[model samples]
Target: MVTINLTLNNFSELPSLLDVFGCFGNDYEYTTRGLLRRKIPPVCFICSTLMVHNGYNPHTKEGPGEINIGR
Candidate 1:
């Protein structure tokens, strides 16, 4: 498994991380509250699971902290 600690100071860095993780199912954004938000798509089960396991909020698909990607 691969693990990465991603620090996204701006929105532009999101795409690269998604591509690296094959998590292109939904577009993600950071809320003003410093939470990561992503739309839950029907075909994004794997992505959602990955997010959840990484400490993202399952219900809101958002997390409060630095972004981390792992496999």
Candidate 2:
């Protein structure tokens, strides 16, 4: 097995890094050091943050041009 390590100083930098990995697809495991763990998804964090900032909700009538429950 092989291990890859990355250093990041800000939470906001996460989205762009993930985007780079995604172009390669399914051949990596992402984790943080000494904290929590999660499986990443194929969505853009920046976009999600912006949507929330704009008062758009997946369950609302004005979210991302789609209607209700999930965006």
Top of the candidates by lDDT? 1
Residue ranges of candidate 2 with Cα displaced over 4 Å: 1-8, 30-71
TM-score of each prediction: 0.21, 0.23
Q: Model 1: per-residue lDDT, tens digit, 1-71?
A: 32334556745776775566454333654445655545442333545344442344445445535776996
Residue pairs in collision within model 2: none
RMSD of each: 16.3, 13.7
What lDDT would each prediction earn against the true structure? 0.49, 0.45
Model 1 poorest 10 in a row by lDDT = 48-57
Candidate 2 structure quality by residue, lDDT tens digits, 1-71? 32335565655666775665555534445555442222343333445432332243354333647457966
